[model samples]
Target: MKKIFICFALCLLAAFFKPASAQFSTNENIKDQPKWGLAGQKYVEYYYLPDIDTYYYVPGKQFIYQSGGYWTFSSRLSKANRSYDLRGGNKVVINEPGAYRYFAEHKSKYGSSSSNVAVQKSQTDKNIKRQDSEKTSG
Candidate 1:
């Protein structure tokens, strides 16, 4: 009876601190995943354990991913390399896959901070006049 009591106590202790896989047994597929993005609360939590890779929602904290360190915004690149679109909310993607520090930079080439939609209208008036001249000559 004493041996049984001791065994039960040890089992309970192990259950409390064991990893997620040991704690739960389910038929879930979680390997060879591509991109991990934000869910509900905040930024995507890209982390690694012993043998596999996993991701979850962890806001106010950040992690960096290392495998394919670069997240692409260019359409010319392969689809798999694409980064998360940040135009919606305060969004970001880990260029690497571990823990990373982020810096905010704009994609706009215009001198002043202006709406990207207005870029077309801001075309150096020189270009517009050149186009008009070409049309008149032809």
Candidate 2:
């Protein structure tokens, strides 16, 4: 009876404890990011394009936009945004997960006007430029 009770307790403890590998699940996306996109020390999860009210996921490399009143994910932007230049366009870095969930707040804060939007250079872009300058100077 004592041996059976000990075995049962051990099994219960094993069931309650998760594997060490599972603790790092949140960073699983980091492994799949493009080399250039991972240049900086900071990890960027998404980019909010206020100009068109779209969100770009860096890890999955997918564009999140509104279509038919629902959030749509696609690798390419719609035809209407084909002319938009991502490099030069205004971008707001959103490190939060599921950034689209706060669409109303983002829209209100960063309206259609460029002047109202607080544009920021992505960390990856900044680091790349820094490395390029260093190579030329060194």
Candidate 3:
């Protein structure tokens, strides 16, 4: 009876799993990386500002398979956030694209010395606007 139960549990687990072939793919050698974003959680799909480099904690999901250059797994995708790991780190299991960089200057400028992740500011970044306003109005 115990053996039968174990077999049944194993079969259930197998049934729940989605084969990697039908799911996602990995571009481990992807030449480009994804752009970076603010501290907010989400994939920053914008023009990458190369001047200021940053290493954003890429959000990821509980992916288990691969299909067509994307990770595939039988899990509901997180809407607002790109999926995050259990420990709340980058969920992008694969660094297919840069997606993020380390902004040393921004860190120093903002007086943020967190060694965990870096962030960049665009030439037209909001902070730049604020500075411009301060310059003109002041």
lDDT of 3 at 118: 28
User: lDDT for each of the candidates?
Assistant: 0.28, 0.65, 0.32
Which stretch of 10 consecutive residues in model 3 shows the poorest summed lDDT? 129-138
How far residue 73's Cα lies from its native spot in candidate 3, in Å, is 26
lDDT over C-alpha atoms for residue 131 of model 1: 12
- 1 versus 3: better lDDT goes to: 3
The local distance difference test score of model 1 is 0.28
Off by over 4 Å in 3: 1-40, 45-102, 110-123, 127-138
Q: Give per-model TM-scores.
A: 0.19, 0.55, 0.18
Q: Which candidate should be chosen as best, given lDDT against the real structure?
A: 2
Decreasing lDDT order of the candidates: 2, 3, 1
Q: Which lDDT tens digits does candidate 3 get at residues 1-138?
A: 999999999999999998668456552322232322223323232221222221232333222332464534324323423443223222212122333232233334432322223223344345322111111110
What TM-score would candidate 1 get against the native? 0.19
Q: How far off is residue 93 in model 3, in Å?
A: 17
Window of ten residues with lowest summed lDDT in model 2: 129-138
How many backbone clashes can be found in candidate 1? 9
